[model samples]
Target: MSTATARSNLGNTIAAHAILITWTVIALFPVFVILINSLKTRKAIFREPLALPNAESFSLVGYQTVAKQGDFFLYFQNSMIVTVVSLTFILLFGAMAAFALSEYRFRGNSLMGLYLALGIMIPIRIGTVAILEMMVATGLVNTLTALILVYTAQGLPLAVFILSEFMRQVSEDLKNAGRIDGLSEYAIFFRLVLPLVRPAMATVAVFNMIPIWNDLWFPLILAPGEETKTLTLGSQVFIGQFVTDWNAVLSALSLAILPALVLYLIFSRQLIRGITSGAVK
Candidate 1:
């Protein structure tokens, strides 16, 4: 019996890892194609899109074009600022709201949770006209702040929903013990509760980061100025009505993909742990 159980567990673990590896490859295959093709000459790109860059076909012209044609660095900077700041706000406020919803029992508690969850069901883009009007009225149009605020609102529902589930899993006794030690509510929340949910927070950050970084809609609508253009928006300059610069487009996409990839690698462990927290065991 013991031997059979051990074999089953081992098999399950192997299957899990295999599935993860397969999914990773599938998800990254397009990115790999883009990255490799970006290093080749335009003619090579058309001739052998899937082939690796040979000595003769290797070129840096695409990268050069990206550097010369637009403010690539500025666009990258704007994207970084918007993504980071928006994620911070989403995590901080969403965690706080989740904690309150999960830890406290009050009148309309369920209703409140339902209210927040509604944001996830409702498409934020439906209110684009209204949001644009509000931003215009507040003079936030063409500002990074507009993007940040919109993304924060856009991400909050999912963040709260996921974090609240994880927050409820935190040990109540642990929190009570902190209170007994004369810790303030804020102290217990920050020092005790938040640490236990770091994986969940990391998960939330990764989920929201990609959408915020890659989003072209809000940036194009609200902050289309040269100074505030995100990487996704700036990449559009390489495309034209009839003659698209495929080389520059690919190079810009490669550059845009790097930061998101780096961030995912950084938080990957926590993300996996958060996602599979209860599934395996």
Candidate 2:
């Protein structure tokens, strides 16, 4: 409130902004470099790597080459289906479980929550041998269903944990009021609690979508067929096949980066808000 105090606070704020900006550039500089160079001729790229693209330097050759050489659109679709379907089930089932855990004070509740959360610390990749055998035994190999089931299982642990934490903070009075109104437990969840948990749901969706979208391991193990390969796995194979083609390589990397960047930009606020609100911890 005093003049000197206010000035000192202002100086601290300026220093914090400067530090944040510095780190932000450090994080984004490599991505910026790749995108700019991907649009330039190879000669121009090497000669003026730091320069903004101009008409003389601008070329769509990389994109053209990537599009021609790879079925990028189909790969994009496969990734979308797996990511979306897995996320939907994770959020729905995770929320229902979270609501029950938070609302009920039953015996062994804490242990149950911890048991489900075990999958969070333990990477699902450790069970790859069993998962693959199961898929093969069930004749689901090279099928999107294989990838979807695996990702859904992998994502559920963290989703339930985060949603349960937030669910605990919901006012008890609301649940009591719903019950007083003769609302069944199912109606309370569907009509009242679910609507109130949107912020937490957005938080979970953003967190889960990234790993599922970017995963290569499960897709490679479960569904490497041309029709079923997700974007990340397909990109790896495509780049391997066209390793000598710099333009296609850069373009393929860019194509992979775009969807993730878009999702981050859209959901970043809610994701950060969730962490600060202690939804996970």
Backbone clashes per model, in order? 0, 0
Residue 185 error, candidate 2, Å: 1.6
Off by over 4 Å in 1: 1-30, 46-50, 278-281
lDDT of 1 by residue, 101-209 (tens): 9999999999999999999989899999999999999999999999999999999999999999889999999999999999998998999999999878888887788
- Candidate no. 2 TM-score: 0.91
How many steric overlaps does candidate 2 have? 0
**Alpha-carbon shift of residue 267 in model 1 (angstroms):** 3.5
Provide the lDDT at 152 for model 2: 85
Cα deviation of 175, candidate 2, in Å: 2.1
lDDT of 1 at 18: 100
TM-score of each: 0.83, 0.91
TM-score of 1: 0.83
